[model samples]
Target: MQVLPKGVRHIPGFLDRTRQEQLVEAIRLVVAEAPLFVPEMPKTGKPMSVRMTNCGSLGWVTDRDRGYRYQAQHPVTGHPWPAMPDVLLEIWNAVSASNKTPEACLVNFYSEEARMGLHQDRDERDLETAVVSISLGDSCLFRVGGNTRGGQTMSFRLESGDVVVLGGEGRLAFHGVDRIYPNTSTLLKHGGRVNLTLRRVNP
Candidate 1:
């Protein structure tokens, strides 16, 4: 059996098909308000493979100028991010061990060819709170490593309705997506992947 790092909880099929559909619909409404925009790498300004948006009081955004940070307004639209969906809030309450509610839900849409580089979630002030991640649509190869760079790593397939929580020692672990499996799920009409990442930005 493969062993994940400490404090990393992988709950497979945490969301049922019905709940997944409902969450997708909620995200659609969020997209309608915030609209997905391609994120850029800090300094280099290279566009990331995934298109991203957010809901909740704060949204995670990165650009050539400001880098990764949470803000109240969309970078392009200049409007506050849509409120966090009830389903997402419920999920966070169910999985997250922290008492504080998540203040940001970063929504990332990944195409079949999209991939994410290994990185840590360290922008938020509340590092003690667990990061709740929900996977939808197609499955993907998820890679995770230790807190330090170039450490031992493990890769696993994450399918639709799967939930991953990173807290405790694993909160600062390096993780990313390797590749997305196309047509693996029929949840999204266009055949891609959607990742909802919930985080607490403040103490």
Candidate 2:
């Protein structure tokens, strides 16, 4: 077992091939309805490298003007996000210690060149709830640091079907994808990585 920072648990190949394919198909349905849209950084309005969409009742969204917040509808389509798939809820129930079910599942589609800067997931009203992340498609180097920026950090490779749980003291840790390795996996049809982050938006 790889030793990660406190409260950070990395479960490699947590999902079998069959389950991974099922998740991919489920996300495909989600994208067909919600569609992925580019997210922008607050103030600067810098566009994020990856395209994003969401599932579940609440969806995470960001724009230069309003910043990061959870909304009931998509930014461009103005339609309510599709409901959270039952498979995701089962994963949360099996892993997340909290009794509350996730209200939002942020779907991030990262191309070969897409990379995310290290940041904390603090938009949620309750920080006590855990953040459950499921990795599918290509592999990427995931970087994780302590609660504060500039703190000690570590990098590890996350492949398809990997599951990571950020809970307890690690709930607010800073983490991000350094870069995506193209053709690393055959999960996604066209080749890319899909990251599904499940979180409790409200207290």
Q: Which candidate is the best by lDDT?
A: 1
Write the residue-wise lDDT of candidate 1 on 1-203 in tens digits.
89999988899999999999999999999999999999999999999999999999999999999899999999999999999999998999999977899999999999999999999999999999999999999999999989999899999999999999999999999999999999999999999999999999999
Candidate whose TM-score is highest: 1
Candidate 2 per-residue lDDT, tens place, 1-203, comes to 55688999999999999999999999999999999999999999999999999999999999999999999999999999999999999999989998998999999999999999999999999899999999999999999988999898999999999999999989999999998989999888899999999999889
Cα lDDT, all candidates: 0.97, 0.96
> Which parts of model 1 are misplaced by more than 4 Å?
none
Q: Would you estimate the TM-scores of all the predictions?
A: 0.99, 0.98
